[model samples]
Target: MQTHYEQEERFRLAKKRVDELKGFYGNLVSYIVVNLGLMILNLMTSPEHLWFFWPMFGWGVGVLFHAMKVYGFTPFFGKDWEERKIRQFMEEEKKRNESFKGE
Candidate 1:
C-alpha cells in the first residue's frame, strides 16, 4: 500500500500531465485557427504566390513536437524518464532534509 505522501505525489504528477495535455491541445487549436485564417487571407489577396505555406509548415512542426511530448510518442526522454527523474530528486531532497534535521 502506498503512503499518503506517495498518493499526494501521484496526484501531483497526474495534475502536471493533465496541464501539459491541456496546453498542447490549446496550442493545436490555435495553430489550426490561425493557419486557416491565414490561408483564407492568402487566397483572397494573392492566389498565385502561395506564401502561407511557409508559416504553416514551420508552426506545424512545432505543433507536431508538442503533440509528441503530450502524447508520449518519442522514444527518448519520455514519461518514464520524467518519472524516474522526479523520484530521484525527491529522494535527494528527503536526504537533504534528514541531514538538516540531524544537524
Candidate 2:
C-alpha cells in the first residue's frame, strides 16, 4: 500500500518529468509554428501545383499533436502532460500548506 509520503514523492517526480519534457518540446513547437506559417505562404505563392501539400501535411501533423496534448490523460507525458501534472502538484501542495496553517 502507498503512503502519503510516497504519493507526494510521486507527484513531485511527475512534475519534474513534465517540466523537462516541456523544456525540450516547448521551443520546438514555437519554431514549427513560425516556420509553418511561412511555409504556407510560400506554398500559396509557389508555381508548383503541389507545393500546397507540404504545408497541408505539416498542419495535419500539428493538429494531431495538439489533440494528443490537450485530452491525453497519460501520467507525466503526452501533450497536456506537463501542464496538467504541474497544476495538480501545485494544487496539492497548496492544499497541504493551507491545512498546515489552518487556512
Candidate 3:
C-alpha cells in the first residue's frame, strides 16, 4: 500500500544500513587480523613485557561501540528513538504551520 517515494525511501534506508554493516564487518576483520599480527610480534620480540593487550583492548572497545551503533543496540538515542523524535518534530511543525495559516 506504500507509494513509490515511500518504497524508494525504504530501499535507500535499507541500502544505507547494509553499507553500515559492511563497514563494521570490515573494521572487525581488520581489527582481528592486525591484532593477531601484533600479538605474535609482541610475543616474539618481548614476551616478558607483554604490550599487545593495550592496543587490543582499546581497539576492541572501539569495535564494540561500532558494532553496537551499526546493530542499533545503543542504550540511548537508538534508531527507533531517533525516528520517533523526527516524526514528533515534523508533526509539531505541521501543526504550528497550520495554526499560523488559519490566522
Candidate 4:
C-alpha cells in the first residue's frame, strides 16, 4: 500500500500522463484522418495515378502503426504507465513488511 504522499505523487503523475495521452490521441486522429482523406481524394480523382497509391500506402502504414500502438499489445496500456515505479515500490513494501515481522 502506498502512503498518502506517494499516492498524491502518483495521482499528479497520472494527471500529467493523461494530458499527454490526450494530446497523442488527438494527433493520431488528425494524422490518420487527413492522410486517409487525401488517399481517397487521390483515388477518386485518378486510380491510374502512381503517386497517389504510394502516399496512400505510406499513410496506411502510419495508421496501422498508430492503431497497433493504441489498441494492440502495448505495455503502456496507452495511459499512465508507472509499472516500474509501482513494482519497485511494491517490492520495497514487501521487504519492509517482512523485516517488521522478522521474516
Backbone clashes counted, model 1: 0
C-alpha lDDT score of every prediction, in listed order: 0.95, 0.71, 0.97, 0.73
**Rank by lDDT (best first):** 3, 1, 4, 2
Q: Tens-digit lDDT track for model 1 on 1-103?
A: 9999999999999999999999998999999999999999999999998999999999999999998988889778887889999999999999999999999
Best by TM-score: 3
Number of the top lDDT candidate: 3
Residue 24 shift from truth in candidate 3, angstroms: 0.4
- Can you list the residue pairs that collide in candidate 4? none
For all predicted structures, in order, the TM-scores are 0.73, 0.34, 0.77, 0.45
Ranking by TM-score: 3, 1, 4, 2
Candidate 3: list runs displaced more than 4 Å. 80-103
Poorly placed runs, candidate 4 (over 4 Å): 1-4, 56-103
Question: Lowest-lDDT window of 10 residues in candidate 4?
Answer: 70-79
How does residue 87 of candidate 4 score in lDDT? 83
Better of 2 and 4 by TM-score: 4
* TM-score of candidate 2 on Cα atoms, chains taken together: 0.34
Across 73-98, the per-residue lDDT of candidate 4 in tens digits comes to 45555334567778889999999999
How close to the true structure is residue 98 of candidate 1, measured as C-alpha lDDT?
100
lDDT of 2: 0.71
**What is the lDDT for 78 in model 1?**
86
